[model samples]
Target: MNRGLRIAVVLAGGLAALMLAGCGKHETAQATAVPAPAMKPAPPTPIEVKKEEVGGPTWDPEWDKIVELALPPAMLSGQVPHDVKRFCPAFYGMAEDDKRAFWAYFFQALAGAEAGLEPTVQAKHAQPEMAVKDEVTGRPGRTSGLLQLTYEDQKRYGCDFDWERDKQLKVGDPDRTILQPKNNLECGVKILDKQIIEKHKALLSASGYWSTLRPGTVSYRVFAKQMTNVPAACAVHNARKTVDGTR
Candidate 1:
């Protein structure tokens, strides 16, 4: 009960209170020091097409009718812009034949670049990612036929390639649906339709099925070289207007 003893006890209590306050302040500082979430990168912007023309050498005589038949109405109307970065101008006031011919040239050019127009050609990829196991065939992935399509495309895009029937046949047999020119090109048409019409992607998107359509790749130059003969009606050099302006 002495005054000195009481003073010592009070000092100890105040020291404990000070220590608790310091700890609380330290915790508050730590809470405030947490970093903010990082921002994601922007998507690639689409490029607008300024002109369309073809100058490639003539394709096989037979492919013209096949491509014309496979083309959907939207492509002829210029509603499906294959050049996604460059906006496609609607083919207003143009003849159906010119539009059809232009698309035929485009496909012929694509076929030439993809497989040298060889229906039975099968290409094995060198890249580690592309060489992964095929989903349908359960073998190393290989791009087959004129459009260089994979067996997995049958499941992914409802393509006509039948792996079960194909496995029984020889590698280059024309009897295989995937190796057939008509089936392969038709499958390509469906894939392009999904990209342009269903997904609203550019004809030449980074994530497109065909590497030949992707810009800045070595294969893209091959495809570009084949575009020398696009129909004249698509190239309105003096129009001086955007796709929106065309509307």
Candidate 2:
């Protein structure tokens, strides 16, 4: 071979080797490279709830004193006076301590407003027959008793039970009189229970009445008025811690 030809062949061979080395490096990089790991979805969050609150007056020990002072003289005369406690067992559950306190306070206020807890023997002018008479004479008046059921009241709550004729046969048993303490109280509580059930459509504890009847409302006033001497009676009863303490 000539010197020029040999030199050209040698340069071509060197160029070919360099190109093959570059190809090998590219293939090695592709094989060694790694893909990123697959991503995971995040977890879900939780929900929260809120509770409701109730409100009312705390039980007071001295509330009984108010009831005792408000009871009728007849109640203190060693006789069962006509008042709310005598009839409405529900009233005894007005507070957390005992329902009797509520009954006593209620009747105490009622007795103070009405005839002082003496056995209301004589049918007052507020009696149904008499009130109707008074109405015709242009003198409308409210009736008496722990419930204070008026003349018109007889038409509504007269005979849920005929305790007067059924329980006792006295011509005019003051205790059993429709407007007297025992009868009036029984009728009143029954009426209230019926009203609550009718309105709410459920059975209620004694405390339920106070909770349902908001203070300063007409219902509270009417209830308080009907249950006169209740505070005084409660005070007397609590002080004695005996049912017969008033007597």
Candidate 3:
């Protein structure tokens, strides 16, 4: 009877050891089968801000914020020395809200879309005059100053002050009203405003102006093409209607 009891006790101990070993194996298998969680991507860095000159209105912090959004790095890099007050007196007439809105439109949005607020003058006749007359009409190619404002545009735009004769200047002299940032901006705005008002079309919408210009492969078209989105800056002015009812 004592021998029988000893054998039974040994059998019980063996069974308990087997059960523990099986439990350990199950835990290891479960750990290996389970998957790890995925990591998330990092966010992009913000653009750095710097102090620079711009022509239009006095530097209001609020207007500066609008400029920051509208103007690109290239425009900011080309600083204009003239005070905003010198050129854009129209800003003074506007309500505070409207003034801020116009700055965004004229300076940030339209200026960016146009040939930029700075002038680009092309001198067609840098060479000595050969005195050749045109078959269609008598005209010489030699001209200078912004917009390549041939003698024709100069007369039309009333910029008769001779930058060429006075300074023997190339492109981008401050005396050239065309090169003046505020003047350039004002001229560009006036041109667009004239077109919109005369045509009596709702020019504020992206599709509206895009359709009117019907931009081909010209340089102006290319500039407009780059500015695909309608600037949020213009919304404050909210003068979308034309003299006529065609939207």
Query: Higher-TM-score candidate among 2 and 3?
Result: 3
Residue-level lDDT tens digits of model 2 in 42-139: 11101000001122211122223333333333322223222334434333333322343343444434333333333343334543533454221234
lDDT of 3: 0.35
Q: Could you estimate the TM-score for every candidate?
A: 0.67, 0.30, 0.35
Compared with the true structure, all predictions reach lDDT values of: 0.66, 0.38, 0.35
- Say which prediction, candidate 1 or candidate 3, comes out ahead on TM-score: 1
How high is the lDDT of residue 214 in model 3? 37
Stronger candidate by lDDT (1 vs 2): 1
> How far out, in Å, is residue 199 in model 2?
4.0
List ranges where model 1 is wrong by over 4 Å: 1-59, 82-93, 236-247
lDDT of 3 at 104: 43
Worst 10 residues of 2 by lDDT: 43-52
Q: Rank the candidates by lDDT, best first.
A: 1, 2, 3
**Shift in Å, residue 101, candidate 1:** 1.4
After TM-score superposition, what is the CA distance of residue 161 in candidate 1 from its true location, in Å?
A: 1.5
Worst 10 residues of 1 by lDDT: 39-48
Q: Candidate 1 overall Cα lDDT vs. reference?
A: 0.66
lDDT of 1 by residue, 105-174 (tens): 6676677788876678888888897899998898886889888898898998888888888899998888
